[model samples]
Target: MVVYLPSLTLFCDSLWTKKMCGAVVLFVFMCLTATTHADHHQPCHSPNMTGLMNVMSLKGDKIAQGTFAYDSMGKKLRFRSNESYPTNTSLGLDLLMLFEEGIFYEIDSKNQSCEKKKLQMLLHPLDIPDDSRFYTTMTAGSASIEGEGLKINIWTGSIPHMKGHYSMSVTMGCLPVSTFYFTETTTLLFSNMEVELEIKDPHLLVVPPFCHGEPVEDTPEGTVNSFLNEFM
Candidate 1:
């Protein structure tokens, strides 16, 4: 069985915006981001460079746009994502990546609701006789790329399908600019990575007002959480 967990491949959301072209199906394309941090629940210093970045997808459909900031201690991110539905109606599901006690909150600003889930180091299962082909190293010019730096050399590939890595840059540190959901036959891309080296405001990482009074189902300790909805 193939298990899906919040690794790197999902990117659907944002801070300072509520723009989700809700059509139910767009929710199928919804992606949540949870990357490596120094520690969760515990407070830490912000990364050297912190700034807002744009999230993009190939084939016309676009994910939510958001910002990210990190430090030597931990990281914080927020975004909303959706596809072009004919409704002309926009409903963005806001998310706040504030991890506490192995948990973080995914919010729906439109509904003024929030759901929390645990942070797990998720792995994927891939079937390939030559596993080496799934990995590669490259360096190029990323002047227009977000988080672009002196050189653009990084490793990228996918574990079957989930946890698809699309972008990686190392100027100040090893930073993952974006993720993807693709098979050997299809592909998706993320650009304008916008990596900054600074510390972000700690208060901004807090959950928004919408999630203030919402109840949540917590992920039990040591459970393999395939998705946040698993707890929902």
Candidate 2:
């Protein structure tokens, strides 16, 4: 049942359509700046609720790779994101977050250190039709994938499932193109999905033993903001 990701060290994780953690951050930002940020418009349909899966996202020269695992019965997720920047040094950021426990771990792969902090939020994408202006404009079309045309629903505006200005694609049966979506232009592609799969790795739910890092004492809001400020 464990899908071995041979590319885990490189961009194996970040081919998702949306950045799950980024949306969690954006939702917080939207809540904080509600007075300044207007809805893209409103939706006429029910909002989309997120469950979990594995996906990758590509944006400009930067690459965000992550694995989003969810336990629907338990109502939480085990996730990680590695964002790579196009620099001579090829700087990158690696992270891991476990819901339900409210633990956020930032892994310094090179230094082999990790920062653990207490932070928790129900990270799920709920895109109400009116959450953004373009929610109503979402059009359903057939996108050719691997020479096969599949019926997909596409929308522009801030991502509906999570938050941010990304185009989103939803396949039939209400499955999101990936686990995350933002910027309609950021392409979200799927590599694997185990909707009925539950996370079994205990290590994924806690800080690794190899990293000698201390836990940070902070509120969920405080810790989440600190984590977001780095990339957002």
Candidate 3:
């Protein structure tokens, strides 16, 4: 089911000063302390799943918005976007990352050309992670209205390997709703998620025939974000 995250856009106004906005964001985080009796547990690590969702990433003044599908069990992710930002355009417009093979394919749909590159890093699944601290429990929408909302647990922590501070909202049933990730400069938000517990098609994870025989390019240095370290 599609989960709409309203919180991410609450402070997106350009009229506010950056320093003031930062303080407001910090205050919101400080207020979400976990209950004393609650267990600080991470979301379930589901090995098999594939679904599509909207993605928005902000790095400095640049913003990238798109939709992506992923197969956790197959260890693959594909992202597509209409207009691209410099932060993401470094790889390619349409990209596919295959973690198991340590490679990625940049597809040029118009020309049906695919460029391959070596993926230097391992895949980081969307799990909340063991180091994450439980923040609090809250509802996304009105529980009184049927089929409108679900209970979610909030979490925050730094991923030492990735060097980013992150906060995520996960359903009580272990599904992810939204995620916010930040480093010294960049900020990423993954919202409007719809995750399935099973793979929809095996071919979704397969490298297309057009990508075969393409010379692999060396991967450049990159930083970790919500998904891949450099290629998210």
Candidate 4:
């Protein structure tokens, strides 16, 4: 899904909330001395985990809340959007991307159907890109006491060959808190995230039995552009 905002482009892939390969631009007005730097936070990878994710398109005024699983070791990603506005856009959409097998499955539990397509891109690990520059460190929540807040690190960079820029925020522990993808006209925000170091339910990474033996077709459409239509 792509949501257009002034001077921003937010693109999200079905496999991972559609911001998979989008660019990132972070505009901060704090101290230059604090904003411009590189450090141990350069490229921190997230461990295999499952968590809740809230995806929002600023200009489009669309929102989808779902659970997502990231298994870096297995090179698999699964997301099931159980709630969404305008119901037909993403609600009840379950997607599984198997990078090792070079395939993806779109399972429709209501109809007991599945669409198997060849996965087109290489694995995009959940981590701060090596090229990312340290933007700044800030506190996440408002608190009366100076020390009573969550410390977060902001990183900024652009995806090579991709239009626009990207920004991501992670806790001091390197857990992803939110990510922003910006392009010429869209702004995509992935926020209200709760990530754990454990998969919680291993079954989420399993291919649904209904999708077994399903013929794999060439990618009918790019996963990044078909997010909104998946629910239809």
Which has the greatest lDDT? 4
What TM-score would candidate 1 get against the native? 0.47
For residues 1-232, what per-residue lDDT tens digits would candidate 3 score against the true structure?
A: 4434344433543525434554554454564434333554545553454444434455322233444566766667777655332344333357677877777887887887887877554534355565668877865555568886566787787756556777787767666666777766567665534455665666656778877889977555563322445434
Local distance difference test values of all predictions, in order: 0.38, 0.40, 0.58, 0.60
> What is the C-alpha local distance difference test score of candidate 4?
0.60
For lDDT, candidate 1 versus 3, the one ahead is 3
| Backbone clashes, candidate 2 | 28
* TM-score for each model: 0.47, 0.43, 0.66, 0.69
TM-score of 2: 0.43
* Candidate 2 Cα misplacement greater than 4 A, ranges: 1-59, 66-68, 75-91, 109-112, 118-147, 153-167, 178-202, 209-214, 217-230
Q: Which stretches of candidate 4 lie over 4 Å from their true place?
A: 1-40, 83-91, 122-126, 142-147, 160-162, 220-232
Model 1: runs farther than 4 Å from truth?
1-49, 80-91, 108-112, 119-137, 142-149, 157-167, 172-187, 208-215, 218-232
Winner by TM-score: 4
Clashes of each: 23, 28, 2, 17
True-vs-predicted CA distance for residue 127, candidate 3, Å: 3.4
Worst 10 residues of 1 by lDDT: 123-132
**Tens-digit per-residue lDDT, 55-94, candidate 1:** 3334334433344443334444443334222112222434
Cα-lDDT of candidate 1 = 0.38
lDDT of 2 by residue, 121-192 (tens): 333332223333332212222233453333434445543223445444444344444323443345443322
